[model samples]
Target: MNCTSLQELGVDSNGIGGKIPPIIGNLSSTNLSKLYLNDNEITGTIPHAIGNLPSLTDLCLDNNMLEGPIPLEIFQPGWLTQLVLANNQINGEIPKSIGLAQHLSIMDISYNGLQGTIPETLSNLTKLGYLVLDHNQLSGTIPPGLSCSMILDLSYNKLTGQIPDGVAGLSSLQIYLNLSNNLLEGPIPLEFGNMDKIQALDLSANKLSAAIPAQIKGCAEVEYVNLSRNFLQGALPSSIGALPTSLHVLDVSFNRLTGMIPQSLQASPVLQFANFSYNNFTGEVSSEGAFANLTDDSFLGNPDLCGSILGLAPCSGKHGHFLYIAIIVVVAIAAGLLAMVCVVDHDLMKTRLRLTAPSIQLSHFPTVQGNATGKKESDEHPRISYRQLVDATDGFSEVNLIGKGGYGHVYRGVLHGGTVIAIKVLHQDHAGEVIAGSFERECRVLRSIRHRNLIRVITTCSTPDFKAVVLPFMPNGSLDSLIHGPPCGGKPEGPRQLDLDLLLGIASNVAEGMAYLHHHAPVKVVHCDLKPSNVLLDGDMTAIVSDFGISKLVITGARDPEVGEASTSVCNSITRLLQGSVGYIAPEYGLGGRPSTQGDVYSFGVMLLEMISGKRPTDVISEEGHGLHDWAKKRCLQHDVDAVAERWLPRDPPSVLPFGPPRCEMEVIVVMVMELLELGVACSQLVPSMRPTMDDMAHEIACLRDGTWRKYRATGLKAIDQTKSKKY
Candidate 1:
């Protein structure tokens, strides 16, 4: 093993389930350039003899059961380019000697038990691209020397003091800078604006004070910024709207910011997510362009901010000029008429005039246009009418009926302009108030939620007698139609079977959409009813989450036992009445638990299992007397991937000549199916805490379509077995 001829060695994810052998460092092969031992079950402290490999350029031993402090001697390699020991129990401070590796470019030691402050010596590694030290117990002020990295993530640490001024001068920082959830205090430095190349910056959950420096507009390339949960005060710089067009997310909530929200934010085309809640902002909230989609939740806790957002009062000065004239005319005419009536017949004429005046006043009410009450061109939506919807849907004809649900029936329609749409008309037979409430709820939810994988609401028509929401028609139809439609439905826009590619793609898209709803949206939304039929597919086979009629907004820190509990009891009752589909509901919900984001995760898990096993949750209960998770877990526990695939696909694995070249594609299929089934089983775990988050699910499913998993499959089932017991 000490031979100098060795150049590279890899034994990754090979089911090596014992302590790492001391002899691993016996490979004194001076010519070795790369050493990969990741994703295995190797344990014990790293041997110091690894420093003998003078020519090593990459050293990866991550995602294992390794414990104890990393050996300091490993940094002796002058040519090392990558060093990853993340997700281990390694303790002790990162050695200052790490700076000696002139070629080091990527270093990830996150998710560890490491302690102590980051070494200032790291600044000597000029080529570093990624520096991740999150989820550690390290404390102390960040060293000013480490300012040139591209991706700097020091979140979830106990670091205090102001951010080092040198960080602002990092011209090479093009990825992200995250220092959130720390005890750092003092004003944000104006120097941050000089980091023009950075994309994302997060300084939330800190003790930082003072106004956000107006110079932040100079961070021209930033797309996302989160300074929430801080002590920031004063008006937001109006120049905020002058930020780069790439700006997508800006959250300054939970602060003491006063005065008006910057108008520039309303005009930003790419600014999709903005949370100004829990602030002291005053004056009218803008409702144009990006603001048109925002709901009252975005401005909650700001009592002084008035706007057209639901629940907020309209500003006194809004339409003041027009209303003033109208009021004066009505008052003068009424006074003159009353005097004449009093003179003509006294009490008799007065009683008769009162009855007629009420009717006349109602007939003179003005028609208000636009989604929001504002004088901005960008707030305009196609002014749709109830009569137009009736005409387009052919008088609600049964022939055009596309689908029906608990709240409404959907009909296919073609408008006068030759645009095709799906009209969701509420069931009028239900109590008019209930129907109206559902419509308003949908409007509020849809207004604030925006994601490519979520359905887009085109326009809405509302009148006393009728109400309907128009959406773009999805020609590819719902996932339910693709999976369980009539046999003669013909080929779909994409694949028919839930193949590895299509299954992973659809699963990834759904996870992304759910993640956005649960975390990234302007306001958190929990889609209480997530199921196959609710997931529609466009022509490109992209999955989009539809039907927010029963969604609930999650108010941060609010003590509500049920969805919408912060609101009236009627709202909570409505949520309970529509608590998701039968088989897809989480176990807790059956026991009177509240509908929550976790419940949605459980439902997605069931849907994932259904996609893989082709068995509904109800079918499992009726036939096997348990949920789908039990059946899948039973097969998984028996190490019977073949049985699960056979029951679902029911086809033999592709056969090739004996001792011939291994079929790489076939390997990927088998490995992916087994892994996916395992993931489904994990997600549908009886304990909600045991279930993986939507973000985690998305990452793992995405791995199935990525090259790393493909290569892992080529290595055989030993690799998949090694990862099964690992954390989600």
Candidate 2:
């Protein structure tokens, strides 16, 4: 513990026995990061000591007999992901405050004595995928919108009332769903038919009645199903057998079901087990295909049944084989017609979009042309699939996610060939073009412009149900993290403190990117949004401005791209969510002025001031006014520049001081901080005409980075101060 960083402590599974406690001394640290004792027989209450590890991300106490109420402190960590307290004797109702763990993707508290209704606040966990609270005393109807989960096991509970329909339609319910042995009643929701990827579904031993839903044939990937021990009556829908060739196991025993066994089940290629016992069914059951090896145990109690199988009375030709053939023919024809309609509708949609498509001419980078199959053709970066992204990011797992934006979430991924990329995946819940438009617009902007300081696209993965933009993963994350650390949980990447020289360099890089967009690119563009979170730092700490989902594209007939006005109104931007970050947004935008290059300059100025002041533009210094501008102006006049910056400064002395030679105590201050603050004030003038151009600002920062401006600091400072004195 003296020299090494204590990252993890694991003494799992019988390493400690009859335990009243595990050693608590090793848990504490000066720079302690992770401490989790998983899978051990550590007895007594769920430890209050676990509350000590704020950095703990995954706490697995699985298969233990820990007995007591789950402490309120368990869900306090903002970054906690996997919480496994399964197979324990833990009692007490789950705290309503469990919803505070927003990043939680997996929560397993099964096989316990907990009571009370499931907290509806679980819907707030957008990233939650696997939730298991089975074998509890919990009652009440299932809380809905858990459609975000791929696995939901709430079996062996006192859950009552009709099932909620909010969970059935989404593709995320692809793995396994179990809600058996409950007091659930009423017909299965019609939305269950949309579970296209589910391989296993279990809803046994319930009070459910009424007819089996026929729309369930759409479960093209179902392999195992159990619908036993219910009060369900009426004919089993033909869709049960039509549940794709993937069907391998079926159990619908112990119900009041009446009907001939579906012939589709007889022809199932992979079906290994079938149980239709204790029902009023009176049809000839075929012993062909998957049912060939089954014994009479599966059909025992059905006295009226007659089939070709071993222990049942043989049926005469009066049952009519042609009837089954006719039913199969009708089902086949209907499926074919449905697929045809889907293809036609898809083509019609493509036709409409193509008619409105803008002609793109990407001069520097390769142009990606969308083909009829919905795949884009490009050679620069390989085309990846939804599955590849799933594997790369561990099924878009919460742990790999680097940042979350309004429209999308970004995850760090390593491709098969070892190329590290940031996968910017749009949230799928948003209907229509809200998700699609963001993907298209960002690609449109990234393709048209190329700059050292601007982020580049590394191909894209797009399908009807999914879309993601691939870009190089920055080892150092966004500038927002660098300046202010994370909003919660931990410190920023790399050094905890940033020197003024590094800040100056970052500001210069941003200006260069913005200047190129406004002046040098083929299409004159307005970066409608520019802020620190959108500004990422790469491996060498080079700043890159990104996220152009709402950028204004100003294409015109002029041969010189920079000289022409926007052919379309700047307000016709793609994303309707937001123009830019509040407080950083230009004053003109709020007053209904058209977007222009001056807006970018104003944003860059605000960012520059934020870096120098170490305070966000949103921080209100006094009742009179808010923002970093007002705060810095007051600080400059009162001369407390070092005091504000010294809070974030490291132990090292200032390395890039502006004044080169020894001077008086007053002159010892870094003049660059003051000049940059003045520059921020100048460019953020309320009057758009008064703001300096990005070109001038870029040049000014570059001189500061190169230390060439130090010779003329006196004149430069005087000019900036005069510019700031105007009626802003």
Candidate 3:
């Protein structure tokens, strides 16, 4: 307590435990200008007495286990400039007296348990530049007068009411202003267009309504704008598509926005990614500039949209022209009848003018309902009737049947309107309630979770006697048929050889999809029946995971029966045996272990190993006594990417990957495959607890992808992206 002359102290990341000592308060060290105690395990409430230090300025206690409300006395010191207390257990409302430290340039208290409305006094700090209060339990509207000059983030909170005009109209935000994942309502402010210097703007996952303002094009430097998962309506502004040349990413998925996608987006020289999924967008998708290599992932859930893009039906000009002509002819005939009636009733109307009035109707006009939640499914999806399915599938004839499973049959169908879909029809002869229950569960999972590498639902039909799920027809088909060939006694689709690069890409996509199911989705999920068949390839050979038949939601797992004799036999014989994916089932399940995300990882690992080796896990299981896990562990020779490259190809390559140095490229491919095999072995270890989570698996796959993509560039090999379109 007598250390009055201490000028500086730093104890960051030292595994320090226990409480913030109470003695720290009595240190009236007037000379102490810097104090750092962040990245510790210290617990207990912050001591109010510490504020007695008259000259104490920099204090950092973030990334600790500190609890209770922020002490009111800490703001008494006018010399304090930076305060960091993020990633802690701190609670209670931010004290209104925070404004007392007017000299504070940075204040971060994010990722805490803090609650209550943000104090309006924040605006008083004219010098404040960066303010972060994200990942908290804060509620109430954002303070009307925030003064952060560079960055202001209040995302992932319970904020309510409309965003203040002053906040949106601020032109000084140079970095970004993120108010995403909140309850902000009303139209996006037109004043937001005035922030010409801001680089990024994110307002996704909110309840904001009304049309996007055309004025947003004024943001001359903005590169990213995310307005997805809102209630915005009307066509996208052409000006947004025509944003400044710096704009790269624009997301407007999961809204009610309608009409044609602006052609200006396709012409953007810098735009790399644009998401328009799950909206009411119509007309043809452009195939130029940024849209040149786009996949079906960008346009899912918009059935009316025709395009040259993969997975979308090609627009038929002859049929469309005749249809338009027919509609115009019908309207003309209706107008003629109405005119004749008006002329005949002119005299009658004058005689009865005092008693009644004539009402004109535009009865020939076509109208469609908006695709918002809570509306009938027919309104959002194309209205496909029961007879329509039968007609499309020709009464579920053998010629239309694409595949069959224990629980259902899959039929390839094309609707009269020229949309191709795969229909999974549940067997009516199966256990009635059990079949219905599984169908409902699959539908629930499909409808709630969405990702770029996950199969998207078209629409589902349910009836007392018949239940079916409709999904987009994957052009390249399932990974099982691609690598291992289709099941026995079926028409051979011919040999399909996947290169190491393509296989790695498919593995990465599957991992990403599993990560979404396990951790990132609105509700955590476990794809209990993950296997090669469940992983399908889209038109670009991009992987799309499908079939959530035996998936489990972690929150609702307790309600389901545990894996045992009662359900184990049924599960193995049905979803597993029917698909010959018993080799993909985690060994823990055989011992009655419950379904888990780790189990999904194990299955994915088995699939990954299979992709690299081009052999099934069950090929010689009985004779060999071990599956691909042991095989990979023994065959894979772990070595550094650079070391392997040097040993196999000593000559420096003139060019990088996807280009010259053919022998070096092949040898480098072998090294990457070995690395992936190592990952597979780790994931498929016998102990379920030893398996890496899907999140970790996804990250590792991405790292491997990037590492392989750039490794060749290190050996004096010039790397040039042929997709020369500039991107940030």
Give the alpha-carbon lDDT of every model: 0.73, 0.70, 0.73
Off by over 4 Å in 3: 317-728
Please write out the lDDT profile of model 1 over residues 502-614, one tens digit for every residue: 67778889999998888789778878778888999887888999988767777787643333532343345333342213368765443324767788898898898888777
Model 3 clash pairs are none
Query: Could you tell me every candidate's TM-score relative to the true structure?
Result: 0.47, 0.45, 0.46
Worst 10 residues of 3 by lDDT: 359-368
lDDT agreement of model 1 with the native: 0.73
Off by over 4 Å in 1: 2-4, 317-728
Instruction: Give a tens-digit lDDT track for model 3, residues 1-728.
Output: 57767887776545566888777767757788777787556889888876876777678787677999999998888887777787778999999999899877667787788999999998888766657787799999877788766557788889999988888887877656889888889999898888987767889899999999999998888877889999999999999977747787788999999999988888888787788999999999867778986887999899788877866656887686566557768979999999999788876766776575422111211222321122434324444467888988999998988766546788999877677778888777425655665776676577568788987766667667888877777777788887766554355343344655567689989999999888889767777878887788777889999887766655544433222322443353333222223368775453334667778888889988887777777543322324677667644453333432333332434333344356466566666767777888889865565578888988988888777655654442333343233332
**How many steric overlaps are in each model, in order?**
0, 0, 0
Q: Candidate 3 — number of clashing residue pairs?
A: 0
lDDT of candidate 2? 0.70
